[model samples]
Structures are given as C-alpha cells and as structure tokens.
Target: MSYAVTARAALFTLATALTLSPPAQAAVSADCTESSITLPPGALYPNGIARAADGTLYVGLITSGNVLRKRPGKAWETFFPGADTVFASNALRLDERRGLLWGNSPDFLSGGKARANRIYALNVADGTLNRSLALPAGEMGNDIVLGADGTVYVTETRGGGILRLRPGETAFSTLYRDPQLAAPSGLGAAGIVLLDDRLMAVANFGTGKLYTLSYNDPKPQLTEMQLPRLIENPDGMGLAPDGALIVLENGILSGQGRILRIPSPKAAGMHQLEVLREGMESPVNLTITPQGCAFVSESRIRHRLLPGHETEVPDSFRLYQLPLPLTAAQ
Candidate 1:
C-alpha cells in the first residue's frame, strides 16, 4: 500500500479518536548545525534521498516525479532530463562503484494516470538514463538496494516480495515472496537492506516488525528480528561503522517520525535500542555519507494528507543532517 492511502485510512479511523495538534518543533542536531539546502521550488513531496561518494545529494519528488540534486554548499537543481522515465520516484540507492543512481517509481497516487512501477538506473556523471525496466503490472516498487555482487533488489510494496535484477540483466525476476510479507490493508515489506552478501534485513510496514532472510539458499530462511522495541513503519535503513542498523520510522498512524540505531545482527534478537533522533514529521528515507554523517528526508507528505493533521506541517519540507555518534562502517 501507499503512504497516501495509509494516511487517508488512518484519518478516517483516528480523526475522531485522537486529538490532532500542531507538531512540536524537533530538536536539531547539535553536532552539526541543522543547516540544509532547500529543494528546487515546486519539487513537492520529496521522498527518497541518497548521497554519492562525491558529496552530491539526490532527492526524489513523489508527487512531481522530479529528481533534484545538490552539491555541498550549492543550491538544488533539477537532475538530468527531468521526469522523462520517472513516474513516482520513491526510493533511491547509489551504486558508487558503477557510477549509477537507482530509483523505484511506483504509481501509488497517480495510479492509472501514470506509468507502471519501474526500476530506473541513471548515470550520475551526466544524469542520463542508463536503464529502465518495468515490473509486472499492479506491482508497487517501493524501495531499492544493491547487493555486494552487483545484484539489484527492489521491494514490492503491495506484492509482498523482492524483485531482483542481476548485474547483466535487463529484466527483473521475483527473488522472494511469502504471505508473511503481505499486509492486511496497507503496505507490507516496505524497506530492505543487505546485512551482508548472504543475509538481508527487511521492514514490514503493515506489521511493524523486522525480518532477516538468508538469500544464499534456494529457499532462504526468513526469521523475525527480535528488537527491544518495535519500529512503527520502518521505511528506510542504513548500517553503522560498528554494524548497527539505523532505521527511519514513520510514527504509528500519527506521522510522528523517529530514527533508531539498533545492535548488529550478530546480537540479533536481544540488543539495546538507541534513539538517535525523534519528533520528525514524516521521515521517509535515510542515507549515510562517506564521512560517516547521516542524513534524512522529512517528507511530511502523509501528515499533510491526513484530515485533521493538515495544519500541522510547515509551508515547506526539509532534509536533515543528523548528528550520529558513529560513522559508516568501512
């Protein structure tokens, strides 16, 4: 399911039950000034964000279908040819080794009007389209990640599975699918990241739990991750230098977001939960830079769409550089 649909449903259910109020200002990271570069004017609903090894930042617009780029200390500019193949850019991941920027375009809001869900690869050097592959009709391509061996994996938000495109392939095939990943109403299997070459950590937005899968086996083993506290709507994730998992959580039905740093998979089910930041509006994506800094997109799109919560967001959205205590693992 899409965040737009999820917010509308929650609005209908909780509009009468929960009191809606203006969002409290979140704390900016003290380590670094909460300094941020604004997206290009009209680049509404910024969703997915990724940073290249060269300190360039790329942001995807969910509504306008535009991808914006900014270099350190520079203003944001429209990337590439501008929404030629991108319909609804949701998640972006950079394959630095190959100089490619991968994005998932799912028509959650513009369904029927927009094109089908697609996985697009663009050359970061010149912002030229490299490859575009359409998924099966009706599949929602929500998030993307690259494997250590150059394999590409994408999350099917509604299909409850992962789609894979090997290094030299132009088409994607179902890598894994199971009922456990299916959501009752909203999204299931929202975010995914490779813990290593063999193991993958996935977030189930519908159920609010994490699962670990070993992709090396023909039929991989999938197990629920036992965390000290469950992450509600875990959308995007990254790894820390010490192997901890950093998760971006959209609050449970309230659009209040948070960032969590949890113990490494070696500790697995029982590990301390570290709250890196909280009180974000609707953080959807997360990325770590080469210098070990963490950045997040405060989309706030869901909060604005929810009925009573429309007045809670600001005139514009923002991207925050978090003051994480750890660095990206070498």
Candidate 2:
C-alpha cells in the first residue's frame, strides 16, 4: 500500500477516536557519552535532519514546522521558530560550499492546509530565512539535492515530478514530470541524489523502488534501478565518498525503520543490499560527516498515534549516530 493511501486510512480511522494529549516536554539525555544525540521529547515529529561540517546538528520538526540546531556538547535550541505558513519540514540539505541550508516543507503536518507549499533556504551561519519559493499547484516538495553546478533538484511526492532551480535563480522551473512517476494514490516520489554530473537517482516510497535518470538525456527518462531486493518505504538518501548510496527505510505504519548501503546504479544491476542498521523507531533522514560518521533521526510516530488510538510519545526524540566502518553483507 502507498503512504498516501495508508495516511488517509489512518486519518479516517483514528482522527475521530484519538484525543491527543498535550505533548510532553522534550527530554534530553543526561549523558553524551554515547554515539547518539538525544532529543527532547517535546521536539516531537522530527523528519528532516542535516549536519554542518563543524558537527552542528540541524533538525526540522513536522509538528510545528520549526527548525532546531545543536552545537557539539551543547543542548538543542530552536533555530527557526514555528511558522503558520510553513506546514512540515521534510528533508534538509546543507550546502556547505554556499553557506546555505535548504528545507522541504510540503505542508504534510497541516494536511495541505498551509498557505504556501515551497522550498526555503536559510543562512547556515545565523539561521535567517534567505529564500522561499512556492511550488506549483498539486505538488508537495519532499526531498532536495544540489547538483555539481549548483542547481537544486527537488521531488514532488504528490505532483509526480521533479523541479529544478538553477544557480542564482529565484524561481524554480519544472525539469521533468510523468504521471507514472506518482504513487498509486498520486503522491509517491521521495529521496533523490545526483550521483555525479551525469546520473541522478530517486526512491519511490509508494512502490519501494529505486530509479535512475540521466542528466545528459534530451528528455528526462526514469528507469527502475536494479536492486537485489525491494526496499520497502525508502525515504531519505545520501551518497558516500566512495560513491555508495545510503538509503533510509522509514518503515510503514510499524515504525521499524532501517538503513541500506548500496553501490552506484551504474555499478551493477540487482546488487546485494548492505544493511547498516535495523529495528529503528521511524528513522527519517540522514547526513554524513566528512569523518564518516552518520546521524539519524528517530521520530517514533507510530508510538504516538495508531490507527484507532493516541498515546504519549517519549519524553524526548532521538538522533542516533552510527560510527564509521559500517559493515555490509558479504
């Protein structure tokens, strides 16, 4: 089943029966001795996460569309306050070379009630809003990845296409669109990355398939990436220095997320999947540091609300760090 369909069923089956309680104050871990960065429970609904070169952590909250950051050995602080216009922040991409951090706000939290569904960029140094461009009608901005030439490529989960913004351009133009790209319920595309100047890859959350598009093609054409097996509910994606792909499986209603490391699509068809971690609680997005360590956000969304009931979430949300030297299936 597609996320869009599952979401509708959940809202219909649970919205009326569940009476949400006041969110608990965020709980931070007393110990930083571990690899993971613990979130305050009150920072509920974290989806988009990114890291700066200096190790500062940035996270976007879906509940309030607020952005938060934490420096090394410091506590999490609100970087961008709640906004009525921005509904939910999904995937965040940090452009270290340009000193900008881009955020995807598809209005998922508002159920599309937000006045503007757009992609916004912030000054990484001070968290000031730099640019906000509204997406075309029927599109929900989901993931963003920067090209080598500074072009921004974004996925439209519902709109069933990709939009592009060239360097120094204020407005985004449609790069590609195909109804077949949309999920069964019409909202499908998720994670995306430009492997290099020529190849681009995307994950279909609705069908659990990875696809590739060539920039050199006169017309954008997408072909299913050959994987050893299906990756159920793939969301966030990242590229390793060695050219391997890191994929996050934001597990279906179960919240049992996992991560995968795979070679480039050009390497081979149906290559074996290397599982980096498993049994996570609704892991959303991830980013890697130059030193090779990766950070992942655990949203635990299902714990807060089931199809027929609502329960209190943990006192704090959590971001776990997986040390380098991640092993793959031999």
lDDT of candidate model 2 versus the reference: 0.70
The reply for model 2, stretches above 4 Å from the true place, is 1-34, 111-114, 303-305, 324-330
TM-score (C-alpha, index-matched) for candidate 1:
0.86
**Top candidate when judged by lDDT against the true structure:** 1
Tens-digit per-residue lDDT, 186-291, candidate 1: 4778778888778888887766678888877889888888765556677888775556687887775765688777656645446555676778877888787544
Error of 1 at 227 (Å): 2.2
Query: Lowest lDDT 10-mer window, candidate 2?
Result: 12-21
Q: Which lDDT tens digits does candidate 2 get at residues 1-330?
A: 112344443321112221112211222223322366767657887778898867788898766668889888898898887455555666888888998888877654335544657788888878788888888766677788887676899988876778899998988888887665577645577888788777888887766678888755788777888665566667888876556678887766556678777754557555556676779876778786654567877776755435554456566778888743332421
**Alpha carbon lDDT of each predicted model:** 0.72, 0.70
Worst-scoring 10-residue span by lDDT in model 1 = 12-21
Q: What is the lDDT, from 0 to 100, of the residue 9 in candidate 2?
A: 33
Backbone clashes in model 1, listed as residue pairs: 241-329
After superposition, which runs of candidate 1 have C-alpha atoms over 4 Å from their true positions? 1-4, 8-35, 111-114, 308-314, 327-330
